[model samples]
Target: MAHDAAYHWPPELMALLTDTIPLLCRSKDDVVDFLRGAGTSEALLGQFRQQLAVDRGAVSKYRIAREVLRQLNEQGDQGLGVRRALLRRVTEFEDFSTCWPDDQLKARGLVGQIRQVVGVKDSFTRMQQERDREHEARLADRRAAEEERRRRSALYSDLRAQLTALFPMEDPHKRGLELESLLNRFFALDGIGVRESFTLRLEDGEAAEQIDGVVELDGQTYLVEVKWWAKPLDINPVSRHMTRLMTRADVSGLMISASGYSAPAVAECERFLALKVMVLGELRELVLLLEREESLADWLRQKTRNAKLDRRPHTLLGVDF
Candidate 1:
């Protein structure tokens, strides 16, 4: 049956069954035979047979019909299937062969009513299917969101640990290289496109320029430079990056400094901000962002916006501590 096991037939169906079954079957034997063919068990048939024996054909058919329906109702959905099948059989009947000649007209009237019952059953089945589908969709979305949350949490923990370890390293050169790798992974975690350290070779196969890394953000591409010097960066390194940016009109520049920039270096970047899109970031800000589990891309984009609108290349994010 399309309905639940706990489903109770409404009074309309109960009344319909009361009128329809007895009219369709002339005697107790006829009723037993019809139910048997419709898959009712022998035990139930024996119970009904015992009831008919008590009445000995003296009981009203209406009483007999109700008794039969009561037994089927107790059987749950299994009983429901047989009851619905009998109703459908009434609608499909070509003739009133089972009905008495006098009751045939009344029996014919029931086909339309039976169709309404079937219509309600079909509608209820469709509603249940739609509810099940919606529940499954919600579960799928929740699973995906939870999986993404766990993935980002693990990546944040790894990056934070790696950054902490680098501050204690004695060799600045090796520390800078590891910093480049860590930054690339950080950008990748935010779904940004990243290219690791690459060198531009001259025509004679000698290295002309060694770019620390490259990344694409918000539709603009940038050549990245990484520095972890003991002293602050001077104007010369910033000037060289400006020269590189000048060579490619389509490309921008970003410099990440562990020790920050000198006054002249900041001035040089500010001066060049009018000519190209350049953004300077302090490594400490990145550390703070990671400690708070903030977005590196969003922080950099804010710096880029500051450079574009305010012509300030080295802008520090206001950290609470």
Candidate 2:
């Protein structure tokens, strides 16, 4: 019957029991007002006032509160039935024991006596339990959010340092090679597992072009092309790379151009957008992605999809801060 004791009564009923009853029980009109607020019909309000009058004749406001608490608890089990509507109107006033004069409460000890008989402490305990659960839930959410923030911040610090090392180059050709090697190290640190100088065999018993690098992600391999050229890339090199993409099965390409591409080169790539084999990006973009702590592979996948959707290989998405 412990479960039977719980009642999710209306806010008016709860407010009446907690705030208006003890202090207002002296007046039939005050109780009537509370009954109306709790959705009580006109018929029961008169009878409920009669019961309070009978109870009050013996003691008064404090004496009637004990029976009021019982009917409220019984509401969970539907014990009150039609009369429950009347009890619903029956409410209590806050600070009743303290606010009421001793004469109105019947006696100085009656407030404590009413609490003992009606088990009001049980309701208080349940309220405290609700507060405790809500407080703990809030704390758990804060802890999880903090943990995610710390993990993300730590990963960004390490990767940003690696990307920063690629800048302020003294030689363009050497920088391109360094960038290629840096990608291998970066992917390795990223836990994507890097393969250097990846090559495939052709039917003529000849080795395919010595590709710069390959990254194996989720059981698929991607050929990587890194270029730190001082000048904008043209269509010739981009076309050559597209030719290399046809030599494999279920394989895609990631082309990193530090200086970006020329207009003709971008147009040529857009022509090959249907192939769904390439994701074009710049060194500055990659560095910014690292600074933002976003997933590099996901970013590449999004750019690849964008090319397929809009046929604009050079378009970049804006990142929100």
Each candidate's lDDT (Cα)?
0.83, 0.64
TM-score for all models, in order of appearance: 0.86, 0.49
Candidate 2 deviant stretches above 4 angstroms: 1-138, 169-207, 215-221, 319-321
Question: Which 10-residue span in candidate 1 carries the lowest summed lDDT?
Answer: 1-10
Error of 2 at 148 (Å): 2.9
lDDT tens per residue, model 2, 1-321: 133335644443444444435554446455455546655445544555776557645434433444454454555655355335544233222345443475445432344443443356458778999999999999999999999788767867876775676677677777667777766766665578688866667999698676888887767677788877779888887887888887777787778887889988888887777775566777777777667776766666677667767676675644332
Clashing pairs in 1: none
Q: Model 2 — which ten-residue stretch has the worst lDDT? A: 86-95
Clashes of 2: 12
Largest lDDT belongs to which candidate?
1
